[model samples]
Target chain A: MHTLTDAALVGVVLASFLALGTSRLTSCIRATAIQGWLLALLSVAIHEWPPTGHTFFIAAVSLVMKGILIPILLERAIRQASVRREVEPFIGYASSLVLGGILVVTAFGIAGRLPLPHQTSSTLLVPTALSTLMIGLLLLVSRTKALNQVVGYLVAENGIFIFGMSLTREVPLLIEAGILLDVFVGVFVMGIVMYQINQEFDRLDTRNLNLLKD
Target chain B: MLRLLVLAPAAAGALAFLLRANAHRLALLVAVALLHAGLVLGTWTALPPADLDGHLALDALGQLFLTLLSVLFVPVSAYACAYLSHDTGRPNRTFVGCLLFFLSAMTLVTLSQSLGLLWVAVEATTLASAPLIYHHRSPRALEATWKYLVICSVGIALALLGTFFLAMAASDPRSGATPLLLPELVLLARAHALSIPWLRGGFVLLLIGYGTKMGLAPLHTWLPDAHSEAPSPASALLSGALLNCAFLGILRVLHVCVAADQAAFAQDLLVVLGLGSMGVAAAFILKQPDYKRMLAYSSVEHMGILALGVGLGGAGVFGALFHAVNHSLTKALLFLAAGNLLLAYQSKSVSDVTGALRRLPLTGVLFLAGFFAITGTPPFGMFLSEFTILSVAATHGRYLVATLYVGFLAMVFIGMGNIVLRMVQGDAPAPAASGHGPPSSHAPSPAAASRESWFLTAPPCCLAAAALLLGVWMPPGVHAALDRAVAAVAG
Candidate 1:
């Protein structure tokens, strides 16, 4: 169970890298959805067999929303806006890959310094989670497309969701569900904004959103 | 009572969404605002019980913010009614609904007692106000909304991570898991030694996260655009009520920090960020071309003052609470007045708008007065609060901070005055000469049309008056509430 959880966490990190390297927007979204599903799978793997209560509930919802629902919303937005498939990132893919590598090293270094309250058998979980978070932020900053930013946001949210799994017993079911609902609504709203941006600008590149200023 | 306070606006928001008649929708907005205010005020005599297993409660701090939100909403809602009447180009169903929903989310932010619940409420507020900011449906409004949503969503997501860290900090393996409740965390901080590194890390992340939402400096890049582009009434609420909700999140985290004996770290960060915000606002406000953007920068400056006051941690905290109310009233008044100016001048640029006093007498006067009130002039509540914060800083021998505080305040005053004075004083430029085109130039001033209806003018006048009244005399009940709230935060 512990090795499986570690492998799943590694899979999550790999998915983030996949997202970082991909120029195709749809493939990036796919990587994030796969990352989300890996997160859901880890919960079940960690708890071992018939997870119940908050664990099962969080896993089920994470699987559906992060895995299935959010990607569907983003894909629909992609179609509706007819946005270009290529990311046309502000930071080139090679450099982003290098940055992601540095972030992963830093995540491990920082994770080693912090003491966890409850020890987990999977040593890679904390570092992987932090790395995922940094990559998400990287994606947000380095991407020009609005939909890609939403993808970055979901990836960042997935990082936090993984972090929360450590405290699954402490955080209430209501709070966890509320967090999921907030993210779902957040993406849903972003999708709507993307549609509006397309209607107004005839393009989805947020680089052109520089109209308002001092 | 708690349910009434939160759910009333929500129900009205849904109702406003379905109502086809604009008049009925406006009436319902005013009615719900009054009812929500009444419920909040009714609980003043006696506190309401915490619902949702202690997840929701009106603590002293909550009461202070709840009162601010309710009080500010009344006038802003009234202003919205008249403001909506002029712009017949777009249907206001989403605009009105989003405003009410914004109010509901802010109410929950004040009421939420648990960190997790508070995160949810704050995130909900970001979602709710995005539509309100985009009410104009122009490309500019769309840009503002998209920025507001993506940036705020990212910021609030960091806040969730901070929340998780906070929970982790409190949890001890030997004791099993502790619930992520503010009061409980405070108790844990007092009784058991918490993991200090995690606690400190949590506070830092939470500050950055919530600071972004609260429009603190360095993180406040999205604020001026969002506030300037949104409809004036929506800007009023965003400035008046929504920022306070974000501040509430930080105050809760500060509460736990105070209990954990990690306050020095938190306070130092607050002071630095607070001063940083003030300096940033001062820099931007200087010769700012747009009047509404000027007001938005002013909001950032005042948020800095709030953080600085609380960080100073004495009469400074009390003054911070007082300053929060004063800022809300005066800032909302100024934004609403700016809204009217937007209508009359048909533009937000200072160069394009001159002699506001000549064109729209009442709004112009209120706008000028509001500038004074916001700049901490005497006879206004901001004056008293700013003085209190400064005096406390001086007495505590933080002379350098005190000097910088005064220096920033002075710079901001001159900066804002340079623009606002230019706005209200000169002769009205011929509308065509002002470059707004022939149709708007020949059109009768919106101020002239809105002047007859007290709905447009009265609400802002009353809000400005309330701000002035509080300065001259802080009501005993309000005074007590501020003291209790300060104590709650100061621990």
Candidate 2:
């Protein structure tokens, strides 16, 4: 169980890195989906005993929303907006990889200092969560495409979901469901807005939104 | 009663979609606003039982904000009736529905006691208000809506992460579980030395999250665009009422930090961010060409003042509480007046709008008066609160904060005053005076005479009067309520 958790956690972190390195929007979305699936797997893997009904349900919801539903939304947005497949990040891909490495080291360093409530099934959980979060933020800052930024937001949210899973017992099922519903509606709204932006500007680049500055 | 407060506007929102006539739909909006206000008064006067599950309840802080929302909505909704009647380009079904839904989401933000529930409510407000911002459906409004949605959604997502981190901090090995409810977490933090690092970390993320919502600087990129592009009534709601709901979210997190005895860390962060926001607002307002964007920048400045007051602790918290109410009334008045100016002038650019005082006397006077009140001038409610915060900052030996606070107030006053003075003092052009300008097709008269109606002008004038009234007098009941609210944060 412990080894499976570690392997899955390591895969999640790699998926984040994959997201950062990829230039294709579809590929970035795919990497995020894989990360989401890994997270759901880790959810059941980390439980000591047979997973309860609550964990099982959370895992199922996570699979559907983060893995399937959100990707479908992003794909539809990309198609409707007619955005280029290229991520066309603000920062170069090579620099992002180097910066991503530093983020991993920083994540581990920070995670090392803050003690968890109890020993977890996988020691790598906190570091992976932190790294994924930082990578998501990095994607947001470095990427110029509005669609890519939305993907970055999803990736960041997935990181937080992993962190929440670290304390699986503390979070109520109702709260978890509420969080998922919010994410769905939030993305839905963003998707609608992105399509509108496409209609107005004929481009998905948010840098063109600079018209309103002081 | 709490449940009703949260659900009633939602029902009204759905009903608005089904109602066709703009007149009847607007009447529903006003009726619901009045009903919500009445329900709030009923609950406050009677002190009814709270929701049993602890999911929803109104403490003193919540009570104050709820009262503000209900009161502010009455005028804003009233103004909306006249404002929407003038626009014939598109139907207002979605606008009316979203307005009431926005109110419901804001009420939920105030009433929610659980951190998770608050996050959900705040996110709901973003979704509800986005359509209202896009009411114009022009490219500009669409762009504003897109930025508002994406930026706020990203910011709120961080807040959720912060909420989870806060929950993690409260998790105990022995108990194996902990609830994310605010009061319960406060108790737990007090009983056990819940992880300070996690709490502090979560608080910072939350500050960034809700701070974006509150239009704090650096994260306030979407505010000017959205506020300036949206219709005047919608802008009034965003500036006057919506910002306060986000502030309430941050206040709840501060409660937990206070309980955890890590308040100094939180206060320092707030003070830095507050001062930074003011500085940013001053820099932008000095040269802002758009009249509506100028008002939006003022919102940023006042949000800074509120944050600075809360950061100062004792008297500052009280001042912040007082300032929150004052800014809401005064800013709403200014935005609504700006809306009228937009309609009469048909252009938001300050260069195109001159001699508002000559053309629209009532709105012009209220706009000037609102500028005075918002800039912390004496004899206005904000003046009293700003003075209180300054004196407290000095007494606490936060001389630097106090100095910067005064300095920014002066800078903002001069900057905003220059544009406002220019706009109000000049003469209207022939085209604008004859109502031949664009968007004037909806106006009935082509005379230079002020086209001001009781509906369009009265709401803002009354709101401005309320600001002045609060400045001179603080009823005992309100004073007591503010004290309780301060205790909630400062304790």
Candidate 3:
């Protein structure tokens, strides 16, 4: 179980790096979706064998919402918006990948110093979660396309979910459901707004969204 | 009963989306607003039982904010009726539906006792109000909505992480799981059962998260754009009710911090952010071109003061609560009146509007008075609250903070005075051709512009009267409630 959880956590980190390295918007979305699936797996693997109904329910919701529903929403947004590449990202993909690597190392360093009250199934969980969160924020700021930013947001949420898996017992199932529901609705709202941006601005580039300055 | 306050508006909102006629939707909006307000009033007389196994309950702090939200929605609903009536071009279904959902979400924010639940409710507000900000459907409004949505969602996502961290902080290997309930966490903190580093880190994240929603400086990038671009009634609700709900979120965390003896740590951060917001507002307000944007910056400024007041942590907390009430009434008044001016001028530019007093007498007077009230001029409730905060700073010998507080307030007053005085005092501008300004399909006819409907004028009048009444006489009931709320936080 520990080894499986470690592999899933590492997979989540690799998926985030893949998201950063790719300029193709669909590829980026797919990477995040993979990261989401890995997180859902971690949610279950962090628990003992034959996970309880509540654990299964949470893992199922995370798998369906994070891995499946949100990615589909983004893909449709991409098809409608008709933009494929991230095209002239504020920070180039190579540099973003380098920054992503640095973020992972930094996450390990920071996680070492932090204390947790309860034991975790794997030591990699905290660093992986932190790295994913930082990479997501890096993608969010470095990308020019609004769709890419949404992808970044999803990655960051995935990172948070990994962190949350450790606290599965402490947090009530109802609150977890509410949190998942909010993320779904938030992404749904963003997809609708992206459609409007395409209709109004004729492009999804956030650089064009600069009209409302000081 | 607590559940009803949230669910009623949510159900009404769904019904609003289905209702075809604009008149029926507007009537339904007014009815729901009144109903929500009636329920909130009932809570003041007899506090409701906690629902969801104590996850949802109204404490003094929540009750104060809930009441404020309920009261503000009444006038805003009336104003929206009048405001939307003139513009029939766009469908009102989304606008009406979203407004009710916004109400429901805000009600939930006030009632939520679980940190996780509060985080969800606050995030829900961001999603619900995003569409409302895009109601104009102009490119700029679209820009504002996108910025509001993306920035707030990311900020809220951090808050979710913070909530998880807080749960971790409360967790104990010796004991079983600890639910993220506020009262339980406070008890744990008091017992020293929580991890301090985790608690501190979690508080900071929650502060930044909710502070983003509350329009605190540095994190307040989305506020001015959304407030300036959104329709008047929506802006009023956003400024008046929504910011307070976010502040309530922070106060809840701060409540736990106080119990943990981490008050100074949290309060120090509040003071820094509060001062930074004021300075940002002062700089922007001094040269603002758009009147609505200027009002938006002033909100940033007031949000700063509220933060600073709570950071001061004694009588200052009381002042912050009082100021929250005053700021809501006054800001709502200003935004609603600004809407009236927008109708008359068909522009938000300070240069485009002149002699508003002559164009719309009641709205102009209210607008001018609201400026004074918000600037902390004498005989307004804001003045008293601002004075209390200032005096608290002085007595604490925090002369630098006190000086900066007065200086920022003075700078804001002068900056707003220049723009507002110019707009109100000059001869009326010739009604420009409607196409000259931003493309607003809802621009009223010249006749409608000149004639101020009782619908639009009366709401601001009532708000202004409330501000004035509170300034002079704090009803004993409200005073007691404010004291109880202050105790909840400052103790």
lDDT of 1 by residue, A68-135 (tens): 99899888888888765655788999999999999999999999988898776577878888999999
Worst 10-residue lDDT window for candidate 1 chain B reads B441-450
- Which residue runs does candidate 2 get wrong by more than 4 Å? B432-450
| Candidate 1 chain A weakest ten by summed lDDT | A164-173
Which pairs clash in model 2? B355-B426
For each candidate, report what fraction of the true interface contacts it reproduces. Answer: 0.83, 0.66, 0.77
lDDT of 3 at B315: 96
Q: Which regions of candidate 1 are displaced past 4 Å? A: B431-435, B438-452
Residue A203, candidate 1: alpha-carbon lDDT: 84
Query: lDDT by residue for model 3 over B275-354, one digit each (tens)?
Result: 99999999999979999999999999999999999999999999999999999999999999999998878889998888
Model 3 misplacement above 4 A = B432-435, B438-440
Residue A47 lDDT, candidate 1, scale 0-100? 69
Candidate 1 at residue A207, lDDT? 79
How close is every model to the real structure, measured as TM-score?
A: 0.97, 0.95, 0.99
Model 3 lDDT, residue B102, Cα: 99
